[model samples]
Target chain A: MNILAMFKPNRDAKHYPGFGAVGVLFFTFLYLPILVIIAYSFNSNRIVSVWQGFSWQWYASALQNEGLLNSLRVSLTVALFATLVATVIAVSAALVLERGQNVKHAKLSQGVVNLPLMLPEIVFAVAILILFSQLGIQSGMLKLILAHSAFCIPFAFLPIRARLQGMDNNLEQAAQDLYATPLVTFRRITLPLIAPGIFAGSMLSFVISMDDFITSNIVSGGGATTLPVYIFSLVKQGVSPELNAISTLIMVASLLIATPCWLIAKRSR
Target chain B: MKKLSWNFWGLLPAYLVMSLLMVLPLLIIFYVSFMTSDAYGGYKAIFSLQSYSQIFYTADWDDNLVLNFQYLKIIARTLFLSGATAVICLLVSFPVAYYISRQSNNMKTFLLYLVTLPFWVSMVVRVYACVLILSNDGVLESGLRFFGLIGDIDSLLYNNAAMMVGMVYTYIPLMILPIYASIEKLDTRLIEAASDLYSCRMNTLRSIILPLCKPGIVAGFILVLVPCLGTVLEPMLLGGGKTMMLGNLIQNQFGVARNWSFGASLTVLLLCIVLLFLMFQAHRTSKLRELS
Candidate 1:
């Protein structure tokens, strides 16, 4: 049977009017903005909307821009370190919470862990600014690293926890029954099983750390600036083909990183 | 204390970081909000209520406070924008989500993936795209002119309508995903059963689908509304900083105004609104559990 035949046919399935049209429109609404930037990035005209001819000069200029490159370096450094720290912390916490045994205050701990996901980004930004200045922590790079990792822990922790919960307990138990120690069992059995989760979690945190604008903008404080902060300042100066080129490049990079994690998550489910 | 497992100690690093960074900082904001701002753009440690009081009343040259509606107006605009965005997202996403839920399995997966794809892109980049499209002689204006929708029009940027469009575009996915999750779990048999009982499409949707998907709708509403309230990019890029939302208002105090105490107070107020919504959601969840 075909996919449609896989489910029982319903008479009312086609009754909803305008839904199909709306779905098509929704996809267009989602993607058209990105397409506009990508298209204009290739335009040779200085005017962003008018297309004279296709050229790569915009990309060439963007690549050579020293300030943009510095910000990109800072963003990459922050994302890399933040992802590593967040994933390790997340995996450790997930192991304790999802170990198939009742842990004390698990609910409360989980709530606290997820609180960052709920609170407004502005609140975290201003609060972290206050925290750092009051504590006299003047390193902008250090502030970005700590603040990014703190919020990113929840993003990393969630997937790892979900993976742990979905794991089969029998494999670990069998290893233990075969005279494996807890450490051996974890290394030989549990760790391998949750590796995909760890990978997914790390990618997610990396994206979040990189995507953060407000927090980084607030806390970077005259020391270092990330790509988003840099982009915001450039945007305030007004739009240019160079801005379009840089934005398109960032969009492409984000997609390239996120798609693999998405495929893994889809497959695991 | 009971003997804790060795494995439990693994949680220490995360807990310590969270406590120091997330929890402590928020508490500091609360404390700093009650302090007085010194002339140097920093706070004095003296306890004062000037920050909180400034929200409703401003001290005039004569030192007598007049009732201030400026910040209150910003708060009202923020609420209206966020509320309108949530409702529009609901109306727009519900049908799309329902359509996806009714698709074949492979089709469903692909469509859902498409919906989530935009979220991976940087938010600043996405908002910048709005600038490219809506500015003078931008794609939107050019497209309109091509279709002869108008004789001449200036840039459509820097307006509340543009801001709303940008917000709905950004957040519609959040609404779609949760609503799809709930709708996917819904038994298709019920819809068939309703039809078998001669219920019309409108009644079946109203009486059956709507009630069943209420949880998803609520979840989507909170997800959309909260971010919209704290949004800074859309207002900055699309609203052209002419319109001030709560997020921009808070950022201003920290940026140009240098009143850290007042900024902290505004943040505290935003935090209270967020907490109230979360508490309401928790109460709803417990009630849902009891019902089920």
Candidate 2:
């Protein structure tokens, strides 16, 4: 009887009741708060807890708030510049690390490049703050860009490296064999193939730069507040439906931008 | 050698940026940790050991240096919270990851996408969502009231339990992804063979699955634990600024207290601990890779 039970082709064993229950419960836990924020954004009542009726007043208010608008503009500017710089640097670094087999201290170089991802953001923020002050560099948008790009290098490097690793070098070798110059082979063959990875890496860096708070908070000077630092200060004052509206809009914007990049990467894989 | 030179040229921009921005800044932090705080919210150029010694000693009423344990208590509390958050995330995420791995390919892709989608949202916004759900007359409380659970129950926000819930919620994905990667690569044939030999479900899991998943578990544990130690947003928002963790302490020193030297020392101490933990994790992971 025990053998029969054990060998009964336990294909349905994967659907064990306990596993299903936990999966359902955990997914609910993961998503409920986000749904609540989205729902509360449209609440007509001023009170966050109660849902009186649906309205779009908070969204209107958020749209018209000058401070919020300015912060959003600053965030967009920073993210764009940081993403551009970080992607270029990351691609170059990744190519060197992956393709340069004879390069000395490659492992150490790679570790140093990726160290920002491992270091605590608070510590990194404080370190940069001290360095900037000591070097007599004033904090502003330029400072924010330099810091964000430095931290974003690793995020952009990982995907690009993976893409390069998986790429068949035969195409580049074939191109070279056909008397194609190194630059031509790179521009024609390598660049086209790694385009998807570059897109994904840029998207990731952009999003990370947009979402940064601790680093931005510590380093930002007057008139250079990013959206997150602005939102944090507002939240410290009190929770309002306008904040909820802003949060929902940010979440939606992220999804719209990120979903396509993610899908492209998925399809490429 | 020519090819190597070309590669080095390619790497020059990134190397220069990292050395100037990341490495130099960290070195400055290490240097400042041994300096004295100036009255103007900056540090003196002269080196001293006062910051290091201040971690354990404080001046009493008679101006005598005495042993103090307030900072030590905060360190202990931070560790306890981080450890608990890691364990809870492990328990909650393992089953979820296992289930996801067992799904069809299409379902797995969709589910993994869903898991990662939340991570793009700002963490402050996520913590605020938790606050909305746990505060007085909030979603959870109101729902419980509707169900007639109790009368005049205390608000759930601004407490240690609330902080834990926030931490676990925020970091659960980090725990799940690593474990799911391992489970996805798992050999189901081993499970079938074990079952064919009359190994019970519990025995199969205990002897086969657990042993194989150790690397992922350790990786996930370290990933979650290390970040939890340095988190400031969750505790500050969820705990209502009533409780102080090491992250908050460091922030306070820099912000309100304006003791850059002390904050630098605290940051240095935290960095040392985190570096050691990461090195250990890397060693274990490399050892596991070798065995495999």
Candidate 3:
């Protein structure tokens, strides 16, 4: 839009706001709702109507809530188990994928792995629901774990693959020339080198599985509702100060969990 | 002894796992989409074009069939919403990313973490918070009324606006990270050179930075748009299920309506559309690079 003006102009960096006025407004729009949400969390109103006053009562209630805690427990466990499986698959796949040959077919494998990412979570969830039902594997912790792992593997693979592709190829070659067995080389040399990617990818998978609602909704089978499903039921069933408190508690919980990953991705960079 | 291909003999564990676990379920969807519906609920093994035809044509059923144009409209809306959201996300994230990129290293990392924090929270919770904020008699409605900004009440929770808000919330970070990475990679000397040559700042920006950043913009656009397009939960939970997206329509067909073929068709069509968008984006980047 500003392609023609560089030929003659005094520097007016301050006068011309770098992004223009539209940009500031955009940031405001992007941020205002979040600030409002944070503020409203303390509203004394049990209902979502206008706030009367502020109090810590909602946070207090959220802390005491057992149902929310149980749901969180389920979600965390699912995320943990799913990430464990996904990390193993992803790290191995990354090793195989980073071998720097069969590039065309390798791309196909990537596409196949990423297919779940492209498909709607609801559709994936629905498909898994149908598949599990047909196979007579009733929905439970096991199904949730497997379903989440299936979806999480791709995310886990991409970063690990990225790091493997970006790293110095000489290390592996040098280890091979040293008479180290491939397995031993991988365990000693490659794994240590790519550990950061593994950690980041695993964390990413864990967060994704934790946040997943659609697939969890489909496969939940009324017996093992995750926190997201619990929140959905809350919104549909009723609204109260309790739900608000729960939302606040979630904010705190995610903030707590995400902090470490955030720091890792930060300091390592 | 030889070049071991990535997918060679040693990697059977991965190939077997994904092929069996992830690949099999989708293959099941493919088959289920082809089978004919049964008398009571499930499908029979009869090879029939009846379900596929019924999605577009009405001759498959006795009397209760409805024209499937509604599904098309829903798909259109989904595309429109996703596109609009992606464009808006780009506009919003671009400057923020640029400004953040120009900051010191510590500030940049801090800003990046801040950008990522909201995203780590559950999508369901975020949508629920949006619903809380926008529901009738909710914070927004009464806030407006309390200040006498509007004399009457209006609901925001179940509208397209709410859906966009939810979409933007989830995807703004996706948009920002790519653009920021690209911006971080930008050569500052070019900007200084343009300044040294007394080139107008806007001209330098238009001629240099934007073109250089095209790849990242396209990447960010796709990262934001694709998943947002297929969102069903956001529409359902935040938009109150009042408006239907293609994802919702497809889900309804498979779940409630027992029209697997139609849903599969919808899903396939949407995937094609996504592919087209990505191709178009890639073409634009290549063209822009050529011009520059």
Candidate 4:
């Protein structure tokens, strides 16, 4: 039966039309919702469902909204701090894991660095919440920054580690042979080579921290609420055109942050 | 080897952060899971096995345990939904990924970028957009009405079907990327050779393409399945809180229910299941890599 089926003429043969149609449909499914959100952001109607006419009222309101602006400030501060801390830690850890002489512990450290990527975000949030409560630590912006940086480590580490692995060590060796100090060799030879990866990693981590919700929701206090948490609370209330406007702005910010990193990654590849 | 190297000391900052924030919290959750719940919404310090037992059997008023499957049902439902989402994503993404892979270099990059573009948008907003599209008088309903398929605006939100649509939509890119990566690396000569030998497309795909793409299929399946298992936002928004998945249950325990110990136990159970699945996937992929 298997042999007969194999030898049978393929009805679904290498037909480009069918495959192309599926591709078109898949892309449509992917983008239609996003496009709808962007389009609705301009709707003059207070209700998102009704399209009265094109208007910039929502955008203007979102821009002037104090709460939204405050959350955006909180989110930006957290993302920047987390990205900075995570990138530094990631670079140091990647250096040890990739370029160090200690081979046995490298695998252990590598696993630890990547562990958060595999764990569910909820578990991470819940665990951190539990730990903080048990330790009498308060949930606030500081705690949120700490948690975000922890979560962002894996994202930052991955690209930096990959760059370190691909790097040629001969230049550093040659620098050392030229009587340059280890710090000097690192400054002149190693840092410049891995700068792009570090930059990309930082950008990626920044965007992730900015976009994160679950951990922020669990860890952020009343005054420390981030944009996603605010959006989530608004969503719980009901759908509004204001959400559409704010989401569009967020989407623009993320694209601006992510596109350069994506281009850098593509070029590096 | 036990002694720290000079370079190893450089890893101290990361190690400290992970230990404090990641590893310590995980350990604390494990500890809390074994403790008893307090009257108020917190856990008592005393060790007890009550939370784990409550997952399967509940104590009756007569001091006898009765078989309870409410939590079990939620877990099973979660598993079923995750499995279905993985399967649907696999089916839809495979052909799309293949199509993208077969495109020209510039076209391939553009298509891949389009697939990943949605990911840059906030997931909460994307899910909300889905709500708008699937709501009564929403795009799907209006489109159906326009075609005379339905006489009235039908609400599709807050149903399993809507939840499934949202899950598949969110995760299809995850499924596509890995499969595309594998398929893109496939040698074109192999397909040409199979056709030259009078082999049908079925045989070529079956014997050549599928086997080569097994690793990717496995990766994509794991990627989609594991996250879907723990999805809370999608189910909450799309299922309208009518359906209780494991994620929602866990979230409830931590939030409204205030049963931290029980929530911790549920999280532990989920972690174990996810870890087991990941280990199995790792073993299978390693073996597959060796075979190929």
Instruction: Give the per-residue Cα lDDT of candidate 2 at A241.
Output: 89
Model 3 clash pairs are A6-B199, A6-B200, A46-A241
Which structure is stronger by lDDT: 2 or 3?
2
DockQ of 2: 0.68
- What value does the TM-score of chain B take for model 1? 0.96
- CA-lDDT, candidates in order: 0.89, 0.88, 0.76, 0.86
User: Which one wins by DockQ: 1 or 2?
Assistant: 2
Candidate 3 chain B weakest lDDT stretch, 10 residues = B1-10
Tens digit per residue, CA lDDT, model 4, B7-113: 75778888899899989999999999999998687888999999999999999999799999999988998999999999999988888999998788989988998
Docking class of 2: medium
Q: Ten residues in a row with the worst lDDT in model 1 chain B?
A: B1-10
Which candidate leads the pack in DockQ? 2
Please, what's the RMSD in Å of model 1?
A: 3.0
Better of 3 and 4 by lDDT: 4
TM-scores for the candidates? 0.96, 0.96, 0.86, 0.94
Q: Candidate 4 docking category?
A: medium
Model 3, residue A235: distance off in Å is: 1.9
| lDDT tens readout by residue for model 2, A6-117 | 6565554333447767999999998999999899999999998778999999999999999999999999999999999999999999988987768888988898889897
